[model samples]
Target chain A: MIEFLNSIQNSLIYKNFFLVLSGLDNTILLLLISLPVGFVLALLFALGRVSKIALLSRTIASYIFVIRGTPLLVQIYLIYFGLGSVKFIRESFLWYALKEPFWCGVIALTINTVAYGAEIFRGGIQSIEKSQVESGLSLGFGKFLLLRKIILPIALRKVLPSYGNELILMVKATSLVSLTTYMEMTGIARKIMAKTFAPVEAFIAAGILYLFLNFLMVQFVKYLEWKYNPHLRLNN
Target chain B: MFKFDKLVFGDAGWGDEFLIATLMTLLVSILSMGLGLFLAIITVWAKLIQNKITRFIANFYTTVIRGVPELLVIYLIFFGGNAVVMSIAKVFGYNKYIELNALTIATIAIAVISATYSSEVLRASYLTISKGQIEAARALGMNKFSIFFKVISPQVIRHALPGIGNVWQITLKDTSLISVTGLVEIMRQSRISSNVEHSPLTFLITAAILYLCLTTISSRVFKTLELNYSKGFST
Candidate 1:
């Protein structure tokens, strides 16, 4: 075991593994920024879908459908190359953000996650029993008060598991930003592969880093689930 | 300034190329989903077994595969897979670079990822099958295999179809990643065309449309199956 550790330490890929792991800084940044922005956008989309106005609801529904049906890779490329190719966009204030791979990735991911997150939110809100709403109203709860006190809390708890799944999916999805030439986890692996021609070693190291990150995220989400939903506890 | 004529099928058009790539995407997605279903059955079986070692192995497989990104898995299979095969062959005195076509690697990689999710779905469906039903099948002198096939499997399929449909949608989108492996799928074809034509928006929008078509058609098919299976019973 000591010899194996020494061998690994002596290898070029292992020596450079920390440099490659540094690419996950962008991955972490993407997650932190996109999740909250996506969540707010998702709330709007979900509300629009469930709103009384037919035009607003239909427009949001179609937008969700388009976003949901497409792949995130295509979406990223479209925003990066497609929008970046436009003359007006290049000249516009948005050029600074759209031209950079990092912001482009964040935008594309946020848009894609909004579609999915909205659907999950809509499902959770809809799943609430009608009697619950009626009871809240009978207790003289106003629309805003009812949404704040009864609806959002229950809906949030119900959607936590699926939302957690979406968060994990977003983390995985950030790997694609490497293709945009951003030095994320997968990007660094590609760089090492290009230099060392040791795709196996470099990719294994990268995969381990990703697995560790995801494991931590999953455990954190599990802790949140435990804390939020006491009714799900086993005889506690 | 967009040229609609270039999108038409002809000597001066990319319509034929797009159509061919669309077919390739469909073929890969269908093949992966089929293979994934087979793997899911085995995985769910392993998970269900009442053995400590088997359960641990199953958990490790699903957790690691699910935790990592699909792109890394594909790259690992494409690179590490060949190295493993070559090293194994070396013991037999056959030393050569064993090359796997992108289609095979992509199919296997996507199937492996899909199987993890599908196994979870299948396990959940299996759990929903009442224990009394299995006991009753045994009470009728049914063999284990017969009970599984004739009694339990159909209901499991009925319960698992929607979940399987969701997995298929994911698989369909995931085949785009195979473009990195040089597969001539829709995404790759669009990339080539856009690079050549200098019309990234046009080709990508076309690819997105092709994807929307595939998803729309498959969702319809799944809905039909769901209706057919639940014909007599009301949800």
Candidate 2:
């Protein structure tokens, strides 16, 4: 056992151990950039889906359908390689952001999650009772005020569980960013494996990190659920 | 002249290659879904019987498969599966290298991942079968097999159609991961085309359209099935 421990400690694979420890920076950066952009896009898409205008609703529906139909990896490839191939993108001012694998991955993941979250939010909005809107209007609330005070809050609460699931899925989906050469946990692990010839150990360590992150996400979602639904609170 | 004509039918065109890859993708997905359905039936049966050990095993399978990301599962199978297979083959006195096809391994990986979702859908449908109906069928001297086929199967299919449709979609999307195994699926073909042609946008967009075509058609068919099934029920 001591020999085994010593072997592991001395191996080049230990670089991956260090890489995994430092990989939290990439993961947090990905989440911070993608989440808010995804949320805003989701909201707009949701509103488009629920819009009274036929063209608006159809356009958003088609966008959601196409995004949901294709795999996230394909979207990433398209954004990273496909978009990057265009001379315009390369020559334009946006090239600085587009050139980076991290931003490319963020753009792809954000767009993909927005498609899913929009559908969930649309469902939540549609499920809201007509009586709630009636009450808001009866109270002389303006359209924006009514939506802010009544519609948006209720819809948000209703979609929170599905949104939580989407967030966790986004976390898992971020692993695909490694394919774009963004040195996230999986990328670092793959690099370590290539150098150290320890595929199993590198992947196992990366898997554990993912599992831990997912567990944290689940706990956070549960807390949010409880916090939002305080009326269900009973004697502890 | 050769360049322009070759652009239409050449190795670089990927026109033929893309079609073949799409066919392979469909083949793998269909085979995996079939395997998943067969496994799901047995799992649903075990769960339905309420045996303690069986229940524990079934629950464990679902938890692990669903809790972990599909990519990890695929990676585990891709990297470790061959070694296990070769060892078993060795015990049988096989002298030659026992080669496992990438398509077969991909099918197995996808089927295993899909079976978790399929089993849950089947289990839920199994439960939705009215207890009284089963008891009545038994009281009427119907055997277990007869009860299962004549009474349970149709209802379960009808009720589970939408959920099963979802499983089909999940399986279809999951086929993209098989590209990592070096299988010439649409994604892989597109990637190759992108690298060779240096026109990643064109090929990627084509691949996306192919996916959209497959999914849109299947979704429409499933919607039709849903409508047909719901026709008997009143509003």
| Candidate 2 segments whose C-alpha is farther than 4 A from its true place | A1-21, A196-198, B1-12, B91-96
DockQ for candidate 2, C-alpha atoms: 0.48
**Clash totals, every prediction:** 0, 0
lDDT of 2 by residue, B142-190 (tens): 9989998999998998889999998999899889988988999999998
- Candidates' TM-scores? 0.96, 0.91
Show pairs that collide, candidate 2: none
Number of the top-ranking candidate, with lDDT as the measure: 1
Q: Score the docking of each candidate (DockQ).
A: 0.79, 0.48
lDDT of 2 at A110: 92
Which pairs, if any, clash in model 1? none
* lDDT at position A15, candidate 1: 69
Tens-place lDDT digits, model 1, residues B189-208: 99998998898888999999
